[model samples]
Target: MSSSPKNAMLAEHRNIPYVAAGVTNPLQEFDLYVPERRNTLDTRPPPLICFVHGGAWRSEDKAEHAGLARRLAAHTNFPVAVSNYRLTTASTPIRHPAHAEDLLAFLHFLLTWSGPHTSTPTPPYDPTRLYLIGHSCSAHMLTSIFLQPLDPASDSASRSPTPSRSPSPPPSPVPTPDSLIPSPALLAATRAVIMSEGIYDIDGLLVTYPAYKTWFIAPTFGRLRSYAPWNTASYRSRPGAEHLNWLILHSKGIPW
Candidate 1:
């Protein structure tokens, strides 16, 4: 007995949240949109597409993307998920890797079908078919986290240097891979990746656009006392990336 129906199943699962590092804030949540219709003969869980929205690393909310998620599911007849992550600002400073770790946590929760944030049972997903779709800052975050291999022993939050005068330590690191971390196997099965208007070279941007350093980079990356740079070069040779067929989208108006 499977939850995913090959035939047209008109259903849209919404506001399905997932836990990340014990944070109960609504920002550590996600909304899932599943196609209302499917190919009847194909008795398989539809492909899964996870979306991470972009807000220049600190401004937008996931709720804003609800229409996009619904459209993606309806048009493609696939399971589409949009997630939220902690944003960084002078007052609420969240640094490098925390955003990505939350995404990783969401993926694990999706694969396992149970997490502290999720209140209802999730539908079955196709383990063999997955896709990651991210925009702008989220594209960068996804690139950073997924480009590196999972070190079961390492904690991204702890590895991040705390701000010199911040009041709270960063949120806890995402769960260590037990028998559940899904990337290795899921990545192998990824059908495609769609990155829209992504920032590929961080250092280059800093060097070329001096104003951006103080305006955007400083608040996002500079907040961290220490961090290893992950750039386009690092993304090219990432593990499991070799198999992915990528569609990189960019606006012609922006000259980067």
Candidate 2:
């Protein structure tokens, strides 16, 4: 068995907290790999490549994929960040949307990140150009972040045969929070999304692999009668989704 080559011309910054340390879950951290610049005169900041690891949304950590991040940074000559999110467990009992929400928070942190704030002497990353790569369940989380349900009522109304009527305004005029929603700037800055072996449709997945329900779905989603709301395929694409370059990859040989 031959081992793959390693990239030596890269600097690794491990376990940098995207969220406030000690204030939030310890898993809300990321590892950054910055490749050595070959040309000093270029002066242009390359796009940052962010990798979201997958272990059925219940396992895996950023530290496990350090080698992959180094290889990506070396090949692309770009900064690579492998992020960690809270996992669903019997003890923790974290469910869907929580994992996706963490990813959103991490994105916000990366978009507004300043190198001076960290003691690691981090290299400046270009916020204008960000490429997201998600493997397995992370892909579902990434899709959920960008393609949220715009209006549940409207979707239900559209399914009905009755004539559509104007929706009555809320009596209180209270505004819905945008905390989970990705800002326009964040959406615009995301240049592309690469989904590898992603679970796009929860219902479809269950039909194909019934065993997955016991393996991860039930643990990650809880006892939901219908998985429609959590299905990434059913979500409406956000404004910048049409503009984003999407690449989907799947391995036929891999049996779930």
Please, what are the lDDT tens digits per residue for candidate 1 over residues 1-256?
0123333643444455677455567777787666654567888777788899998778888779977876787788887878888787777777656677777777766776642234655454575677889898887766665554334245342243454454444422322112223367656766777889887666655555667755766666663333233443343335665777778898876534
- Tens-place lDDT per residue, model 2, 1-256, is 0122235677676667788646655588887787778788988887899999999988988878987887788788898988899998777767666788789989988887775335644445888899999999999888877776537575652131221143321111111124457988899999899999988777678877888877887777654344655656666778767788889898886432
Q: What does candidate 2 score on TM?
A: 0.82
**Maximum-lDDT candidate:** 2
Which candidate leads in TM-score? 2
RMSD (Å) per prediction: 6.9, 7.8
Worst window of 10 by summed lDDT in candidate 1: 171-180
- Residue pairs with clashing backbones, model 1: 7-40, 8-38, 9-36, 10-36
Q: How high is the lDDT of residue 239 in model 2?
A: 77
